[model samples]
Target: MKTPGHIRAVSRRTVLKGAAAAAALQLAAPFIIKARGETPLRIGMVDPLTGAYAAVAQNEVMGARLAVQQVNANGGILGRPIELLVEDSANDVGTGVQKARKLIDRDQVTFLIGDVNSGVAQAIAQVTNEKKVLHIVSGGHTDTITGSDCKWNVYRVCNTTSMEANAVADLLFTKYGKKWHFITPDYAYGHTLQKAALADLQKLGGTMTGNELTPLGTTDFSAYLIKARAANPDVLLVLPQGSDMVNCLKQVAQFGIGKQMHVAGLQQELESLEAMPPEARVGIWMFEWYWKQPGVSGVDKFVAEIRKVNNGKVPTARHWFGYTSVHTLAAIANKEKSLDAKKLAEALGGFELADDVKLQPNKCYYRKGDHQLMTSAFVGEALSQPAGDPEDLFRVDRVVAGDKTAPPEAATGCKLQWPT
Candidate 1:
């Protein structure tokens, strides 16, 4: 019924109102986003939190939690809070792979950390590599993690068996005798560790009295001890780790084997030493980290912070491994200002940890070619009695730099291939 001009006017008014509403919504968009908050960056961790490595694995988690707290308190990665989700690997490879897939596919984690057991670590690496997730091997020490089997997306914070062996080989040969026997674990970790040690011993003109391969979780070491004692080696290298090490060392002390021959090992953990009796703690070994470094910068603060969460127990190398792994992701991502896996991986090629994070006297950095952290080894002997502090169970004889202990990257056989 209206005139044509009137109808046109009404349509123009409606159009203007709609345009005004659209402008208002555009103005409100940023505030709505701000109110909704940013999505938190998720990190997945897998470890043997329930099995033989539970004690050490839990310590690693504790360190990781502390790192997350510290990172959020400061500004977090890419200005978003970090959420760490941990899964128990149960010290089994099949279970570890399943958990890794769950973290990658179901939980949608941006970064991955895990596995005190080397076999489980390698299995998890396959998943991480396929998914293109950034992964840091927190405690697994098998050489292949950073050697022949190394992946572009994977980096290791712990020392390889070859590094541990090289750290103490000369000292063991000079101080102890040249004749040696081994109580090695029957997994990839023990196999490579024994091989590396044997190579070092042969190079030093040492003789192997005998070598015994003990299966993982074997509680009865009596038969192995009998064979070792019969051989009458100058040194007995007890190489089993976690609960196995505790059982073997307890039996060794019970048999009074330390009194007959020198007891030594390449890599030893404070978690194992604390679980053992004073007599069973007898050993010359290398600690990837030690808490009682007198003159080292940042060591005191790190120890104090860990004690709050650790029931006043000191931080072990496993703890440092977890802390460094989390910090590695945050530090590199924040520095590069991007969460892209390839970009971050390239940034971390030769990244040096900060002084506070390193906590050792020597320089600590990742080797560019292999992505293995060149952290200092705390070479020392276990103390029967507390040196000063109740938790001080080691007497650090030397702080050897990792560069000196680790072989050349070319020698490691690591060839990193990036996704095309």
Candidate 2:
């Protein structure tokens, strides 16, 4: 039983003790913060996660997520963890631009990557350029993204339409025939791809039998297939990608179009082939990246890691695009010791990717003139049945080097204007 004065004295001592403890904590706060390390470096990724390109776009996101995990595990970007903020473009140009703005302004991301749809990718590029954010076009293959519409800050991981066309044109002409018919998607990507392919065909003295500009997200491709078969072309090019490609090829097989003509296209994805039936998976095409490269330094490890998150599915080109995009930013930023967009952009112009990151036999580097990745094109024929693994649906015929297929930098119409 203490007196009221004694209780008050005890209370005062307790309050003084708390004050001293608080001061001690204040003194240790800086050390604690230093030990905890700096805040995460944010990277914003935009893609069509819920539309025609959803499967491939989601794969891209998956690859980016893995790269983020790898980056943070190593030492992170400039000793800071990487925070990847992903937003869905929904395959719309307007939505892509809006998402890009949200990531740049509200989220304050240091870098940006996106878009399977070339139109959406270009739209996002405008926003990224205005904001001066370092951007990587992860999957979009329109020629102008790294050509006429290219910006100082925008670099592309995927091959250009011209590169793809150059890769497969000779093979198609020699193996198939001279007359070609096309069922092309009506978009920037399809348009550019068709134009480039046509240019190559003409250069090889091949004649275009017909070209049907099918709308994006078209579920029924019977009419287009009918027109293509009716043309009686030596080869029928099914040029839509992602779900669209799956749909087109499915209808082509159902209608027995492949039996009538040699079916092929320029760029094909593992995601699309997986979605397709056995009969529909007949084509000669080019893969931007393939998971089945024997003796490739990092491909096996990459495939194993991707399988962990991708439901045991092997990685497609889209995944490599996303993975390479994030790693590119991290590698350049770490090397330069700065996140300045211009510095990173300048350094990236002729930067060569490491063997592990490249995952291909060829020397992969970003071309200085156009900021386009010079990666090998996996030219192959789609298998109706799995050769070995269930997911091994493609047999690589030849791995063409980018420098061998791609035109001279002067011909690409890419005049990179660096910021002063």
Candidate 3:
């Protein structure tokens, strides 16, 4: 556990030098703003093009595209259309760094949105700070990403592992009568989330039987599954995403081990559920940002339009995450009333979102305390397919409010607070 003083909400240090602190201001910078003859709001989204995470990368690209269309249809950001440039980073750290440089130096994007891998996001954050470009991350969640590597130039809009812990921490332990074990990827994000979840579980009177950290692309999980089943824990937290998740489920089902323990965690896309056989995925639970929970205003239309765009097939959760982040970014720039990165960042601190369909506009604001959005996370269970449904998949089971699950200032492990 982080020491009581380790997760300080008050920013203990300053890392952001002002935009004016940058030495070179281009002559075309003035023309880049579009709304009122300011710089055009040039944004870039860097994602994987060819990798295990390709499907998710494509989903992010599509979502950003949708937001650009929506923003333009509604009269673009400020006035000019949000000119977005997308580069394929292929989930490689070096590739993401190179692409970020190209986006900032050659393409002159005012802000950026992606780089799916945490390592890449960290590298890109470094470059963005040196060049003074605002990088809005929709992917990449590690405590240290916002902890030690944090900078004012970088902001995360996705549910951090912090939020996921609050969403699922005591859920299985208390409600489902589950004592837990963790199977996590051997990286910072996975380990961090696992730690937080375990801490939360411990706080709720649960104990972890054991945990196993596996390599990134390990395909065969027979050994791990056997060990987990042998432990006989009531529930398992499987936190791998992409192909690794698909393979783990297949192997878990092949051995019929999940019957011994319930499986639940944060899932990447709906496609992961579809990737498995019926008996394998039944009753598995997960959390996402955009499932259509009951009475969730505007979700039906948002899902409908998304299905329409995808040839009547439901869009993946990743697609909605990317789409929503783009809208959030555009809305912040809109609130800023200019394309200035600093202004947008300043306004992001006070920005709020109502829903997926932009209805009932609320005074939603990003807590300057930690740069986390004051929003909600949707938790869902795998549902049994009805007789005539198009597919057997998961639907949202509950909505967890951001504030409800929000960790206090002492939990983020962040040292810097935004300017109030």
lDDT of each: 0.85, 0.85, 0.65
Q: Which ten residues in a row have the lowest lDDT in candidate 3?
A: 19-28
Estimated TM-score for each candidate: 0.91, 0.91, 0.83
The true-versus-predicted C-alpha distance at residue 383 of model 2, in Å, is 0.3
lDDT of 1 by residue, 1-420 (tens): 001111123232212122212322221211111112667788998988776777788778778777776776677788887767777888899999999999899879999998899999999999999999999999999999999999999999999999999999888999998999999999999999999999999999999999999988899999999999999999999999999999999999999998899998989999999889998888789999998888788889999887765656778898899899999999999999999998999889889999999999988999889999999898989888876776888999999999999999999999999998
Q: Which parts of model 2 have CA positions greater than 4 angstroms off?
A: 1-35
Candidate 2, residues 178-230, lDDT tens digits: the string is 99999899999999999999999999999999999999989999888888878
TM-score of 3: 0.83
> Where is model 2 poorest over a 10-residue stretch in terms of lDDT?
1-10
Clashes of each: 0, 0, 12
Using lDDT as the measure, what is the rank order of every candidate, best first?
Answer: 1, 2, 3
Candidate 1 vs candidate 2: the lDDT winner is 1
Query: Which is the leading candidate under lDDT?
Result: 1
**Worst 10-residue lDDT window, candidate 1:** 1-10
